[model samples]
Target: MTNPAAAALIARSNRLGADPKNTNYAGGNTSAKGVETDPVTGEPVELLWVKGSGGDLGTLTEPGLAVLRLDRMRSLVDVYPGIDREDEMVAAFDYCLHGKGGAAPSIDTAMHGLVDAAHVDHLHPDSGIAIATAADGEALTKEIFGDRVVWVPWRRPGFQLGLDIAEIKHRNPQAIGCILGGHGITAWGDTSEEAEAHSLMIIDTAADYIAENSRAEPFGPALEGYAALPPAERRARAAALAPTIRGIASADRPMVGHYTDSDEVLDFLAHAEHPRLAALGTSCPDHFLRTKVKPLVLDLPPTAPVEESLARLHDLAVAYREDYQAYYDRHATPDSPAIRGKDPLIVLVPGVGMFSFGKDKQTARVAGEFYVNAINVMRGAEGLSSYQPIDETEKFRIEYWALEEAKLQRMPKPKPLATRVALVTGAASGIGRATAQKLAAEGACVVIADLSLEKAQEAAREIGGADVAVGVQVDVSDEAAVQAAVDAAVLAFGGVDLVVNNAGLSLSRSLMETTEQDWDLQHDVMAKGSFLVAKATAKVMIEQQLGGDIVYISSKNAIFAGPNNVAYGAAKADQAHQVRLLAAELGEHGIKVNGVNPDGVVQGSGIFASGWGANRAAVYGVEEEDLGKFYAQRTILRREVLPDHIANAVFVLCGPELTHTTGLHIPVDAGVAAAFLR
Candidate 1:
């Protein structure tokens, strides 16, 4: 933070990176060259500060900047090997560190350091890439910017590409930047302000040129029946198909999913030329690295029957894997990194939009965004000239490059529930919220479902925002509402791998005091609601074909036969039996159904705050505030039960430790003998 040059470099990077029009997430690098007093020699030494590997520009900090000695970086030119050996130079950047090196140098480090400018930026703007991927890109660049920018033919990013750009800069002294053919753009200036402006100018000029010269209907006009379906129908279909697609995508390894039906994506998919252009795949390295070489597109029209489309999806998934493996076979060399994955990361269903999968939700979402960028690039390229991306062989090389392999190896190991998604009912507060929080901490993307949408969303944000959790409203007693909540989970994070049937209500009443309405309400919300939730989410788990867990939040009252608790006890007892029944039936599908029985969770209990606490206190002959302690006194362990205790029980039942646990109730009631299984 003390270094002025590095601070200014971060500022400039943030400005350029804040807008998607400038660069996609974590897709570009920026640099500033300045003089720093050496600690050992006490002499001014030239230092190059650049954005490091695996860091996003917008969120970059001082530690994310890689500082290298300029003289040592330029020295790599003396022993420069041929293009085939360019990758070796990346390791060499480590030796050129000015200090502790800040962060690991990226492959684009040489490009930033070698250029003779005080500041430099390399970006993957959609407009710039449009011209870069155009068939007539070189001439188009000349026509668009005249002498202000030059064009460099496609070269894999490495030491040699850096030298290529440096030479181009020397020859064209008047040029501020150049379009990297079949790639992106790089701009430079004597100051940070000028450098950022030059980058924007190049991007803006390209966008304007495309706009002026592009012909109408660049995607070759929308096919009549392929247009997007109505909003409600589109979402319903998306919800129906997401699980199957997700299940297929997770075959290689479990993957979290993200769904999008943006106008840009729908428009592109609806066009006549989409089939041909999509087959060619994305041009930029950044695009395909996340999105994969191509998407798995449903060949059927948007209006196809749901069952018919489901059948075709299975066929398409099989074909996609085969095609991907063949692509590897065709271009893979002996030294190529072993095939990473054979599944398509992006799945395109014309009316339903796109579904992208990754190890986590953020990655899946970003992959989808990158594909949108590719769509924009394709639109622009086809508008002016025919879209022409690098050949498949080059894409294969970059996809399996040793440097990329090294980056992947550097990533931290995933958590136990890393790729799993969980849906917790009544998650807006108390035990349900605590359970949702714990599951999310263990790395599961969670759906916080409560009767109140506002409270559910609030809890979700508190848990970790949209990346890790989403909120939806549902009255669990309503079958239709329960299905919609499950659908929301599928649409938000692929399929549901875990379901917590925790939504419930309590009415402490004796046989004479309890009315038909009270009995129906308590049973309706607890026993029947649990059934509805389990049934709805089970469908998704079945579709996933991956083993899952469903835990019910029953009560100690289910067995203790406490006075004036007849209605509540019966509902809880019903839930306990339902767990055993469903576990027996669902075992075939790898879905484990379990229950947690808790002794009067009064503190932080929404049920207690909603009048059940006073009613239970009256039955126990204790003050309302003393109810938790009174319940604890009756237990052998004499420990007050909190929401977190029940939450921990839920986690133990569903977490890695309980892989074989099901068809049982774990008492989290501090050893209540009456509640023990008998």
Candidate 2:
């Protein structure tokens, strides 16, 4: 017989509306029993109660109990497959008996059998289902329950599933229960009442939550056009239309099915601008694992040729695959694994709902849940803004992150290098000043390295010192001044990790109009000065064995040959190549090297104003505003690059998180290279 407290808790669970339809859509049985045996004596000890599979806990009775020898039941799983299912599966349970007759054990009986606790209870709660169906549900569970609960993504319920739960139980001996995705939960305790009480509390809390936040309002009104079609006609139309969407034909028809009579669907069908339907279908990271990045949006006119539609779908899928391959090729390392499989995780059928595919029922459910959550979030966040999927490089890093996988096994902690210490040349104002400010905001200490003593002091005062930042006047072009700055850095903060070589002069003149004096001045300030600082910093770093980062601020003109500014371009180009060589030689020593080529970094910098004032007057015979517009329009993204953007690139290079990256030049010019190529 069930304990009175367990019975009450089950009643509360049902009152809270925590029960969902059983897996077979029938009234299912539930029971609670305990198994106790004296290991040393090899004799029956005490009978513990557990919930039976077919009984409902809300009105449980003692007669619903299933009795078995705890030791015998536990051993059966290890040897069950060896015996024929007809004789061995249910026949073995007859050896042990308690008050009432024994019924077939829960499908998860093996899992319950392995637990040493006295009392156990299991329930199919609606709250658990709702949380499991949401995006980032595992994280949400952790937030609510702390470490008391363990979460396992959806898996089939059977013998193999029981083994999986056993493994988790072994790993987390203290876990009270696990939230199984697309399924319910299993809560266990020393007393049946305690187990059932906790289960009731959790489900009640979740059900209350869902009730409070549920959005039952329709997204749009029903449409007469779709409602006019017969059910058979609608099903046929959906199936015939499915193949037109790449990767959609293979997916199971949506279990919840598509919206046949919604105003949103009708409006979508009327317009050619429905690519957003696919973008809206992706709202969470889980979907990416299932669906790849983007899905095809199918919107075919009634008069369109069937052959053309089929060919278009095939072509779209092939193109997407090719793009994926190109991204992998560009970002994948030699140690990277081969592509796992080729199939889109989700597909958008224009005027219809989204379709999600997976290899199995559990995977399919996960994909579908992710798709729905993503669509909801996208809809909620400012009415369906476009989603920018992570680039191929980032995806490859995530997919092949062995170190990250290893780290997941342990608890995480904050590191000392979580914040950076940066030294910026000519940082009193202009690009240097802007770069220093940007770095500090991103959890970095800024040392304003400049030649002007007064300006450095003033800039430092303005930027503040709470962030562990200061100003040091040092002529980077001067060897003694550079050495003094390095010594000051070591004395002030034990070490420095990032150096930005931004101090330089630009002299614009055609090659034929250039003088030897102009060429020497440009090289000394840009090339030689960068080398001097790097060499001094390298000596200090090698001794301390604390590798660092160095970023040279080059120019877009370095990549594209121009008529004038030959000296500046040549010097900048040399600085870039020098960074690559430094990266190769110093990589083993744990130092990274990179460069940034920014196009139009105006605002705070005197360099941009000075260079632009001269260039606009001489080249375009126009004012500065017109020149800014001209440069901004020349870029493919049609945006002017800012000093903050360049600083961001430099910060990325200096970050310890990017340890594997080196010998790279990131152009922070808003797709200027693509424009130049065109």
Candidate 3:
């Protein structure tokens, strides 16, 4: 943080990375060469500070940069083992670290260090890549940039590529940058400001040239029947198909999903050239790494019948897997990394939109964005002339490269609930909120469903941002609302793997005081609501072909005959029975149904604060403020039951530890002898 040069480099990297037009997420590297005091020698030494491997420039920090001695980096050229052994040079970078290198050096370190300029930027801008991937990219570069910018033929990024660029820069003294054939662009300057300006200039010039020369219909005129469907219809169709697609995509491993219905995706899918262009796949290394070689595009249009489409989807999935395996077999060397996965990360349905899957929500979302960038590149290339990219063999070389495999191995292991998505009803406060927090902490992406949207969103924000948790308002008793909540979960993170039926209200009243409305309200929210929520989520779970969990937050009153709790007790009893019934019926689908019985969670109970505490206190001849203590004293354990205790029980019942346990009711009520299950 103390180094001004590093601060300026971070600023410049962030500015260039902030826009999708400049580069895809985590797709570029920037560097600044500056003089730093050598701690041991007390003399100034020249150092290169470059964005490290796997770091996103927009969020780059000092710690995310790799610092190395310039002299050591340049010296590698003399001993360079040639292009065949270029990959080994990456390991050699360690010896050049100025100190404990802040982060692992990237393959592009040589490109940044070898260049004579004080600042350098190598980015994958959509416009730059369009020209780079065009059939006559070298010729187009000359026409668009003239003498100021040159062209470098395609070469896999490595120490050899560094030498190539440096040699080009040295020979062309008048050039400021070059359009890299079938890759992207690299620009350099004496200062960070000059480097950024030059980068922006090349990107803008390429974009303007493409715009002016583009055909009237870049994608060969949108197909008549392929136009996007209505927004509501599109979402409805996407929701229906998402689970099946996700299940197929997750065949190798469980994956979270993200859906995007942006105009870009829709427009691309509707075009005539989309099928052919999509078949060719993306050109950029960053784009295909996330999107896979090619997406699985549905042959049917969006308006097709759901059942018919579902039937076809299964067949297409089988074909896609087989094709992916064939691609791997054709290009994989004996030493190539084991085929990563046969499933397509992206699924494209004409008229509907795109559904992308990944190990987590953010990754899934980014994959979709990368695909969109690919779409733009394709549009520009087709408009200018013919869309051409590096051959399939080269793509396979990079995709299964040893260095890429090493990077994957370096990633941290996933958490227990890493890819699991949970929907917790009544999550705005009390037991529901506690349960949501605990689930999120364990790495589950949660949907905080409650009657109050504002409160639910507040709770979600507190748990984590949209990636970890999202908020949705629902009246669980309303079947439509319950279905909508499930749909939201599927759209947000593919499908639900866990359901917590914690939404409830209590009215402490004697038989004489209880009315029909009181009974109906209690049963509707707790009993009927639980059934509705279970029914909706179960459909999705079934479609996903992935086992799921449903835990009902029942009450001790379900078993214990407490006075002045007629309607509330009946509702609890109904919910308790549902746990056993659902467990029996849903067992075939691997869905475990369970329940939790808490005696009296008064401390953070919304029910307690909403008159139930005072009513129960009046019935027991105790002050409302002393009600919690009074209940605790009556319990065998003589301890208060709080919301978190209920939450802990929920976690255990739904978590992996109890995978073989189902139709079980956990008691977290400080030993209530009277309520003990027989």
Candidate 4:
């Protein structure tokens, strides 16, 4: 049988943790107290089982819980000592760990220990933060909870906060919880159920109050279409701007970029007051640690040219960093450490959408989640009266708290490619998409450049997340668009480490039957487009002084052409020649240029979706449906070459395997005697 206290606390933590509305990623914590035997003495002691650092509440486990001696932890608090309470508090939590738990306790462990109830739940719910940060928050909270909830002014979480909570707990034995200004709500009960229920109840009550009082604002850009542009145009716009924003927010670190136009996000941004509303500092103190006090606002006009947008992004990025440095200077103290991040985690782009940047996709999405929660809140807050968050000084205290710094310090080390960025053209689907997925899985940031932004975004979404693998639209043959796409990749991911020149268009007509338009399309994408992307991105690689890989997805038809596939074959041949030429020129600079010739990818490759494969199948006297097997059987190994197989070959070049190999084309077409090089 489980200890009743632990049972309730665990249940509550799991219940609240599962819902984003209740807690952002790892944002809230809970604790339960029960007497436990000290293994050495077999004597009962008041032990607190609390959420540990790096543990998510929704997935709490017994091991994930940090066990500490409550009495020992409370005693660590020195009464009116001249010592720094913040630093001293950390030492106490460390010392009080039961058997050291071999786990770092949650940052709020001290405060949880101070709560008098058998169970305590602290959550940064959307509703709670809304009420906590709204104008006249104290009065509104008092009105909602009456005397059941005590109101505590915002205090940085540490020993001092623990002391305040303990004093409040003792003073108001009948109180169900406390509302911390510019922070979050805390609820307590004799059982885990009561504490968790009331914790949610606090959120519900505030939500009801805000909903009843606030006015509903119509959501709109009132545009004719969802994006007010063609699918291609919309993609080009997002593709062009995403990297610029990523580069600006990077601050010399590899920042994962997420561009989203979710209905909730865009609806909020569509508001006339969206800028002012989002300008409000983070609703809760802990989120300040992830997103900073506020988001960087980018009012990039939708109609502006790509170059102008890039310039604006640069200007704003400079200003934001300068402001951040100034903010740090204002709060610099002998006790304060240097700021870890000099850039805002969130960026708001009205008339478009918003972006979240972090060291990785998970972190960036976490920031995205916080902003979405803020969107949910600002509505209710605005509906009632107004949103009022903490000022700059308070933001400084929480953002720079030693405990917060320690939390980041405890994060796991990044993967080998975590800092490297790659660009894959024609990434909307097929080999390009597969390559992007593989590179991202290996920890490299991927810029998915395709002709269709929507398809690129969809592919990016499928591979990890939108932030980790970004999508851009580029007509590789268009010099301006190709340059913009490269700029986007550089700005978004810092510098380029790899380029998969794979954008291709298959043509089944012979040169005698193919129109000039169709022939040019093939040459433009397969040959000229590859050249433009390679050339533009090469400039970035050369400037960064980082050796990079350029891998081309050339077709076996480059060397073995079918009767009706003259245009595609010739174009592919051109790309192969360019690969060798580029390898010779770039090898001097440590840039490896290689090509892979793949055959028999008719089904999942998506290259045949345009009926090109079916047309070729007719020439072979086979049904379109049998095109895959037909080609597979023709190969020497009698095996189908999968998109994943091609992707693996691309990875070989992207990784260290090709350190000494260049100007080579690895064949993935099983064994084609005509295509095999001596």
TM-score of 4: 0.74
lDDT of 1 by residue, 438-517 (tens): 99998999999999999999999999979899999999989999999998999999999999988887887789999999
Candidate 2 lDDT, 17-53, residue by residue in tens: 2333211111222334433445668775554344444
- Decide which is better by lDDT, 2 or 4: 4
Estimate the overall C-alpha local distance difference test score of candidate 3: 0.92
Model 3: per-residue lDDT, tens digit, 1-678? 447778899999999999889999999899999998999999999999999999999899999999999999999998899888899999999999988749899999999999999999999999999999999999999999998899999898899889999999999988889998888999999999999999999999999999999988788877878889999988988899999989988988999999999998999999888889999999888989899979998888777899988888889889999998999999988989999998989999999999999999899999999999999999999899888988898899999999999999989988878899999999998899999999998889999999999999999999988988999999999999998889998999999999999999989888999999999999999999999999999999999998999999999999999999999999999999999999999999999999999988888778899999999999999999998899899999899998889989988987778899999999888999999999
Residue ranges of candidate 3 with Cα displaced over 4 Å = none
Ranking, TM-score, top scorer first:
1, 3, 4, 2
TM-score for each predicted model, relative to the true structure = 0.99, 0.39, 0.98, 0.74
RMSD of each: 1.1, 26.9, 1.2, 6.7
The lDDT of each candidate is 0.92, 0.57, 0.92, 0.78
User: TM-score: which is higher, 3 or 4?
Assistant: 3
How accurate locally is residue 261 in candidate 1, as Cα lDDT from 0 to 100? 97
Residue 601 alpha-carbon offset, candidate 1, angstroms: 1.0
The regions of model 2 sitting more than 4 angstroms off are 1-419, 674-678
